[model samples]
Target: MSLPVHLAPSLTGVAPGETVEVTGDEAHHAVAVRRLRVGETVVLTDGAGTSVTGPVGSTGKRVFTVRVDDVRREPRPQPELVVVQALPKGDRGELAVEVLTEVGVALVVPWAAARSVAVWKGERAERSRAKWQATAREAAKQARRSWLPEVAALARTAEVVDLVAGADLALVLHEGADDALVHVDVPSAGRIVLVVGPEGGLSEAEVAALVGAGARSVRLGDEVLRTSTAGVVAAAAVLARTPRWG
Candidate 1:
C-alpha cells in the first residue's frame, strides 16, 4: 500500500463536500517533495481512521486545495492505554514517550520516582512537559491518528499514584512479582493504566506506596527491562489483552 497521506491543522475542520486549504509544512512537503499535483488523487487520513479520498486542486509553494470526495469516521480505540512511566535519565524518557505514542497509547504520564535521574521541576518541568507533548503530537501524526495522546505534567510518586487510582484497571510492572501479565485476566473495562518504574526499579517503599494507592503489582517476565522499554512492553501486553485490541 502507498503511504497514507497526512493532513495538518490547516486542512482540519474541512468536512465532506467542503474544500480544504492546506498550507505550511505539510503543503511544502506535499508540493515540493511529494510533487503532488492537480488532478492527482490521494488518501488523506486524519490519523484516527477517519479518511477522505480527495483529488488535489491548486498546488503551490505553501498552499494547496483539496476537495473532499469521501469521509469515513473511525471510532477511537477502546480500553485506552495510559502509561505512567518514571522519567529516565537523559533522552531515554523522550524515547519512551515517542515509542509509547507510536504504540497507540492514549496518555503518557512522566513520573518522578525515587531512583529517577531526570528531575522535571520548576521551569525545567514546564519545558520537559512541552517537549513530551510535542513528541506525542509528532508521533500521532506519523501514526495517522485522528486523536492525539495527552502528555501530562511531570508528577511526583504520590501524584502518579493518585492519577491511576481511578482507572478501571491499574497495574505496576515490577521484577520478581509472582503475578504474570499474560496470566492475569481483566474485565472489559475501557480504561486501563500501566505504571513503569525508573531504571533502578521502584524502591520497596515506593512499591508499597503504590500498592497502597490501589495499583496491583504485576510481573512482565523473568528478565528485567529498562525504564524506557518497560512502558511500551507493558502497554502492548495490556492492549493485547483488552477486547478492542482484537
Candidate 2:
C-alpha cells in the first residue's frame, strides 16, 4: 500500500470541493516518494467520516493538488466503541493501541490498573501517552480510517470507572466472570465501552469497583487472552453485533 492520504487543516471547515490541495507531508509523500502522476486518483479522508475521491493535479514540495471527482460521507457508527485497556507489559502496551485503532475503536483510555506491569508515572507517563497517540495516528492512516481514535491520559481504576460509567454499556472482560461476552444485551445509547485488564489481569477488588460502577463483567470464552489481544477481540465482537456495521 502507498502512504495514506491526509487532511489539511483547511479541509476541516468544509467538505471537499472540486479542487483540494494535500500539502505538507502528504504532498511530499505523493510527489517525492509515491510518485503519483497528475491523472492518478487518490483517496483523501478528513478523519471525521468524510472521504473524497480525487485525481492528482500537480505535485511539488509543499503543493499537491487533487481535483475532487466524488465525495462520500460514511454513516457514522451508531454505537461508538471505546476501549479502556490496561497498560500492557513492555512495548505490548503500544501494540494494543495500534491494533485497537485499526479495529475502529472510537476512543482509547490507558488504565493503570493495580496489576499493570508497565507503569506510567510522571515524565514516563507523558512520553508513553504521546507514543500511544502517535501509534493511533499511524494505525488510523494504515487502516484508512476517516476518524482518529483518541488516546486519553493514563487513568487509575477509579478514573476508568468514571469513564466507563459515561458509556451506555460498560463491559469488564474477565476470566473469573460467569457471564459470556454474548450475554450482555446491546443498548441503544449509541456508545459502548469495554474495560480490559493488564497482563496480570484485574484484581478482585478492581472488578468489584467496576461492577459497582455499572460495568457488566463479561468473559470472552473459556480461554484467557493476552492484554494486547483481548481489547481487539472484544471490540470486534461488539462491532459485529451492531446493525450499522452488519
Candidate 3:
C-alpha cells in the first residue's frame, strides 16, 4: 500500500535526516485519526511540488515530527488543465471538485452561470468556496499529488470569457455541439480550459459569448452526463490524449 500523505505549508530546503515538525489540524488528524505512531513511515508534501518520505520520530496530542529519509521535487506538470464548472445544486459541487482533483485538473473555477439553479451569495458564497477548496485538498492527498489543484474564487461569466480567450485551447461541453472532443488537437504544452454548464444547461447567449471569446464548443459523446461528471469525463478524455497522461 502507498504511504499515507500529509500536507505541510512549505518543504523548501528540506533535506534527508532533518526533523520536520507537523502541527495544527493536520497533525491532529494524523495522530488521533490515522493513528500515526513513532517509527511509522509516511509521506509529507508542501502541496506545491516538494515531497518528503520519512519515519515518524515522535508524536504529541496535536503535533508530530518526522525524520526525513528522502526528498523529491517534481516540476509542475505541463499542459495544465483548467475547468470552469457551473454551480451544481446540492452537494454535487463538492463531488465535481473531488473527482476533478483526482483526475489531475490543475485548477477549478466555480462559475455562476446564467442558467445555474444554485446561487452563491454573501456567507453562502464564502462557505461554498471553502468547501470546494477543502475538498480539493483532501482529494489531492488521496490522489498522491505533490502539486495540489487550486479552487479559484467564484467567477463571473465575463471573467470566464477572458480565461477562455487566454487559453491555448478552450472547449465548451455542449450537448448540441457537432464537434467531438477526441478530434480536437490538444496542445503538447500550455493551458487547456474546459467549461461545463449546469443542469439547466447553458443559455444560448452564454454559449455565444464563450465561443466568441475563442472557445470551441464540443461534445463528449452521444450519451448525456450529469453536470458533476461531465467535466471529469471530458478532462480524463483530453488528458489521456496528452503527454501528461502518458
Per lDDT, the best of the predicted structures is 3
C-alpha lDDT values of all predictions? 0.81, 0.83, 0.97
The ten-residue window of minimal lDDT in model 2 covers 8-17
Span of ten consecutive residues with least summed lDDT in model 1:
3-12
Per-residue error at 123 for model 3, in Å?
Answer: 0.7
TM-score of each: 0.86, 0.90, 0.99
Off by over 4 Å in 3: none
State the lDDT of candidate 3 residue by residue for 61-166, as single tens digits.
9999999999999999989999999999999999999999999999999999998999999999999999999999999999999999999999999999999999
lDDT of 1 by residue, 1-246 (tens): 644465645344657777777788878878998888898877566554566768887898988877888776667778778899898998887899999998889889888889988888789989988888878877876776766788987778788778777878889998968898998777666778888998888899988887888878999999899989988988888778677677
| Regions of candidate 2 where Cα sits further than 4 Å from its true position | 1-4, 10-17
| Cα-based RMSD of candidate 3 | 0.6
Candidate 3 backbone overlaps, count: 0
Higher lDDT: candidate 1 or 3? Answer: 3
Error at 244, model 3, angstroms: 1.2
**Better by TM-score, candidate 3 or 2:** 3
